[model samples]
Target: MAGNHQQLLQLTYIRFVILFCQCCAVAFALLYLRVDLNPWATGLALLLLGLLNLITYARLHSSWPVTQPEFFTQLLADAIIYGFILYQSGGGTNPFIFMLLIPLIITVMTLNNRYIWMMAITVTAIYGSLLVYYVPVVTALSEHQHSLTSLFNFHMLGMWLNFILTVIVITYFIVRINRALQRQQQSLIEEREAKVHHQQVLALGTMAAGTAHELGTPLSTMSVILHEMRTDSTLSDEHREDIDTLQQQVQTCADKLQHMARSVAEEKDSEKTSLATELLDEIIEQWNITRPDVTYSVSIQEDLPPDLRNTTALRQAILNLLNNAADACPKNIEISLRWEPTAIWLTIRDYGAGLSVEQTNTLGQPFISTKGKGLGIGLFLTSTTLAHYDGDVKLYAAQGKGTITEVRLSRRSVHG
Candidate 1:
């Protein structure tokens, strides 16, 4: 009932109309037709149902996220109240006998399959009992009922038409409303995930920047120490060689850190001049260093595509795809680029453990990953970033033994 809480409100309103209809029907029988029965008992029975509806509304208004059990209980009350009313007011002969179908129809639209069965069973059992034990409407009515035979045909026809119309209209509108509610719920979930993703990215960036600042001083100290050791003439040749290698590695690390610092300054400038080929080349070179154990290849047209205005996001998204392919099984991977006037297409195919039919269908859903210990963020973020560029990613099973991931960005995404 987290999602089905609205059922309470709907039932409350329907119950109100039901009470009004019952009271009016009873009053017409008593005043016009001079119907005979225990007026006090019947009035008391109707008042109880009205009170039940009011009590339900009051309780549900102050509370929220009504539970399924609670909803079931309230609906069960409707069945019981109507059953009691049916027994009192000439049961099977009551013109409102068909009204029992209302709760069953509402159950189908609102409740689970099991609850639908429950409503159906409850209403059917109560209605069947009415066939045996209910007072006859003709028996209860006074002798004036015998004189109005001429108008009964038209009156019964009108009532039947009214019932049909009410059932059709309510069922159609309620089903549509339920569908709209479901779509809204899905959108809300996606929006919440997006907010969480933004927070995670920001927090990760802050942490990385802080770590870089902290590591910079130690890397500088190592560079100084290694240089001094290499310069020491008293050191053995092998020791001096190791020191030189250490110094070179430290310098490389420092250069990378410096580039990281300078990237922010160069972002706007790089956007204008960095051709797509050059951008891909830079990413490949960086990936090669990170994953030297795995063999990879790249193929594309001779003429490169143009650079994007904001290149980092697209570049990072591509790298993430490459990383996913590499991680799938690090044997053989291919990156192919295709460009046309309308869009840029980049396909990465890995000759490794591929996805199944089911996995491919739900490829981009957040927190859904096939690999062990995978946080499932990389692809989610890649898809998200590409979405901002009016691009999309598609995953397919390779012809033989791997996965083929394709990315596409419209022409506007790669131009200023």
Candidate 2:
């Protein structure tokens, strides 16, 4: 993000230079044409504009906040100054009236549509007012100087036509370019999400393999104890039955551990299942074990339709939210899951320190986290997963209160 800002600033500086150069070029052209304006006044205005452009360029190069409102405020000021120069040189009769399109073009490219429209309206008003005030002055000056009335009228008409045509062309291309850029940005975001998901899968597989390896010894010892108890000759019939039951229970646990290990081993090689209930359950159980001090409660709606229940990504996203809630409020974390006709909703409520307005706004953005030791991947990944399935995650918080994170998935049920 910082790099992107730097790039934008660089581009802005280049634009400033380009505008300055264009102003200089226009001034030179006017001098060559021997316009009626004072050469000294035009030269002075051009010099002032060039100096302002340099200042803008220097400021953008500095480490100051590029998005600061003041930055754009100054840019608007510079644009107005340039417009005034054009007005002074020829007013409505000036061939340079079409140059007013430059600032409007820059505004459209750099700002939101609403801001662009506001600027357009403002420029139009300014231009119209200038024309109204300058038309009679220009006409009087031309007549006093014995200038040809027909030629002056023709020039004025040409300038108006040029201004109209330039505005139409600039607006059309700017909107088209903005839409194309938006699509490219969306594509880049999707690609980054895919990479992050793949990375997470690799990390989970590694953790699972390590956990399975670590649990092997304890399961083996339990198995040996059960074997010894079953073979003891001194055991009574009732005792033997109890021992048999104990052995079966131990065997079941061992089978589960082995299955987990196999699953981890096959994670990279095997295809993923559409239904992720087992995976979700395992994740919850693991979190329960890891944070035994935390009281965690999860309620999945029993009537969840097949379509909603079958989405692996949605399950993982819900699990991530649950885990984040548990981590936030270790002593009292509650998660509830429900299904509606159009969506599946998972809410994780925590009694920990609530987020501020700023944090809430940037909740799922990368590197924006509230926890001290948190890598901040949990919520980001969950948000990304939800987005992939045409879903959303929302965080609500109040002052001195807790946070409620709601994950909403599009599919309502797995029944379909």
TM-score top scorer = 1
Cα lDDT of candidate 1 equals 0.77
Please provide, for model 2 over 1-416, each residue's C-alpha lDDT reduced to its tens digit, 9 standing for 90 to 100.
33334434543554555455546545544444334555565567667766776676677667766562454465466557656666665566566576666667766566567667766887787688677665222333443433587657656765675566556555655665566567668878988977886777567557757877888788789889878888889989999898888888878877887765675466445534343345456567766665677786767767633344434445456767766776677767777767676776767788988888888887776656788888766787777667766788999993466888877767633332
Q: Against the hidden reference, what TM-scores do the models get?
A: 0.55, 0.42
Local accuracy of candidate 1 as per-residue lDDT tens digits, 1-416: 44555667777877887788778777876776665655787888899999998898898777567887788888788788888887887787666778777777777777689999999999999999998997655523336544566347534853685487468647764876587568768978989987887876777568768988998999989988887777788999889888888888888888887887787577676665466677788888878888887787788877757665446667778888988998987776888887888887889999888899888877776678878888766787798778877889989998889999998877786564
Report the Cα lDDT for residue 334, model 2: 71
Q: Tell me the whole-model lDDT of each prediction, alpha carbons only.
A: 0.77, 0.64
The residue ranges of model 1 lying beyond 4 angstroms of the native Cα positions read 1-150, 273-310, 323-332, 338-344, 354-384, 392-400, 410-416
